[model samples]
Target: MPSEAPVQPPPPIKIGGHCFEWGQRSYVMGIVNATPDSFSGDGVLDPAAAADRAARMVEDGADLIDVGAESTRPDHQPLDAAGEWARLAPVLRALREAVSAPISIDTAKAYVAERAFDAGADALNDVHGLRADPALASLLAARELPAVLMHNQRGRPPVGDVIADVRAGLEESLAIAEAAGVRREMLILDPGFGFGIGPQQSLELVRRLGELRCLGRPLLLGSSRKSAIGWALGREQEPPSTRAAGSAATVALAIAAGADIVRVHDVREMADVALVTDAVLHGRRRGDPA
Candidate 1:
């Protein structure tokens, strides 16, 4: 008999009226940095400009918009709860009114998440994976919001093989999210690319991303315009703004490796990339044109 097809994970729970059906097609999450010191050089300090960017992302086919006030770049100065809230609140409020797509607050602080939720944000994109603040999980559970738990260990040296290292870290993160009353359906996993880990390790994780499916949750890949991509392209000495094409290449590879959503800075290009990739991987008909 022919081999049985792999069992796909259940559909993702709806967040802010968006149904993320895993394996149907990959989704795009656009990045909207609201800080003055974003590493990607795409920061929009003005609330109005931030809102406009969010709207444009939605128009560019972004399924979700992630707004971050504090930069997650390595060794970056951390923003306090009040400061982060001040930057995120206006953007979240404006995007809530300006765009129909779900708005994710990319913050590790519980206080900021609370305020963002109150300001109409729909999800929490925690880079610390609920480890930064004890109250973060409780808030996410209480609000019953969708979350992206990423594995980040700032300044930690690589311990073993890249995939094995990432897998172990994500397993711990998954346990924390589950223990905090966050349902499996409402949780997504990210294998922290470009965070603490080396640039080569980041590229290795993208190539070996399929292994993460053993956790049985949707996987989100956020390699857009990161320094690692630049390094892979021999542009480590250059700026991040030039990594768009490299980012697209990684996005396509991640999708083929079982990424459910790709968080990106250049939405228009990545959205188109996802469309063609989806058609090739999941939409190709046997008798269709070559």
Candidate 2:
């Protein structure tokens, strides 16, 4: 099928002193996992080390840092609000003072989000898409901060095909956000890759990612170092750190498909990929004296 007709991007969203000019170029969201059991083996346990890592990512061209204390990988350790906050607090406080870029909290618990907001998190990256915690929407509405409400298929029965399921899930999450007075422009949509589907389905989601732009919000693609890439490369037993090449391939394709943000573990390398791909697809040259 032909790619969807291009639509004008919505107005820029300002969060934590960063202006996200959608459609001008793709943004890079560097991930900082504070858990001991991260799937990617890049988790940082010390608060200072995490802050240092975020500073390095920003230096390497990350637009924002996403901090998470819990591991979302398969069979990972389960974390409660108290446990998560324990690991996330010092890290968030350190990041607030360490880097100039905005910070996004990756969690679904309202209690954790509330405390994270107080501790200086600029945005929310709710993987559960408002389905796990009802209070999260109200908090976001009250804070009026930016958020990424992903179409999470985990533990939910599919309504239809991949795109259909993604659309349906996102629409439901949007409805929930709307009811709580969360502004439309403050929310970005993500198709929850590998959250519920297998490798092929995750790849299909990225291949047809352009179709989701009709949802009228910016899209965020986060297939970095995920198992789907390993499966695609026929190296299922390889470490996540070795998936950078596969990850870069998806980032390029997703950028061409109208992805506005790419959440990644390898910030410097993916930033280069985003820069070049953005140049080719959107004429976003690095040294243009615009």
Candidate 3:
């Protein structure tokens, strides 16, 4: 019989003075939606509420907190830079002062990211993956911050195979980042499960997620309470809040399939899910402790 190949470890990234040793265990990124229309039904309108959410997530074992002002839900009303900054700045300032965990600014605009960094955000998570704002990649490069580049589009046709399509799309994003001077080690790849893709394809991406390890960057999967999970649950008509169990299933499978980070809405529940998944998949079995 052939021997199984060893898993290649993902490079470490430091944010807010904490180092994330990828591949050591799956990390949980808690979501703090500063918008009023978050798909997860957990959005908070006030900075104090967002700050409170961040603090609780950190207490619930979240490795980091993702703070986003604009809602990314399908058909969400787009916000201009000023609007986004207006919603984001206060939350970033208060969260930075309250939570010791690293904060990630989820925005596609470079201007918002710049102000976020000024407000003490530790990293940038761009859903458009440099396709929306040309200045975004350069800004991240200049700041030397870790980046999460997600595959994204609007009404694009499939390339027959979903996983291959995701890879090809992300390749274009990688090129843009590299051309803008962002190093490969500073990049993390997200397959963009819900954005501009159908529900079945999103499930296929989760099922074939291990194939994305070929990209050689730490994979961050954000399938939390997405429409895909609702569809998979045979409850496509259900509200996003009802998809927690479905999200947990996907998170566990993602961890088993080589995902290094899982971004989720229900931080406490997903944190416990990741903990057990890590123990089962990454923990060593030896004699009982002395």
**Which candidate has the highest lDDT of all?**
2
Error of 1 at 280 (Å): 0.7
Candidate 2 residue pairs in backbone clash = none
Put down candidate 1 lDDT per residue, 1-290, tens digits, no spaces: 11111486756679888788887778999999998788998888888888899999999989999999999876678888998898788778888889988889999999999988988889999998888899998888899999999988575566778777777878887788778898878889899998888888898878888888888888999999898988889888788889999999999999888888999999999999999888878667423564
The predicted structure with the larger lDDT, 1 or 2, is 2
lDDT (tens digit, per residue) of candidate 2 on 1-290 = 33452668867999898899887889999999998898999999898999999999999999999999999887987988999999899989999999989999999999999999998999999998999999999999999999999987878787668899999999999999999999999999999888898899999988999899888888999999999999999998999999999999999998888788999999999999999997887564966854
> By the TM-score metric, which is better: model 1 or model 3?
3
Off by over 4 Å in 3: 1-6, 285-290
Question: In candidate 3, where is summed lDDT lowest over 10 consecutive residues?
Answer: 1-10
RMSD of each: 3.3, 1.3, 2.8
List the global CA lDDT of all models.
Answer: 0.86, 0.91, 0.87
lDDT of 2 at 188: 92
Off by over 4 Å in 1: 1-6, 155-157, 285-290
Winning model by TM-score = 2
TM-score of each: 0.94, 0.97, 0.95
Two-way lDDT contest, 1 vs 3, winner: 3
Give lDDT tens digits, candidate 3, residues 16-110: 89998877778999999999888888888788888888999999989999999999887689999999999899889999988989899999999
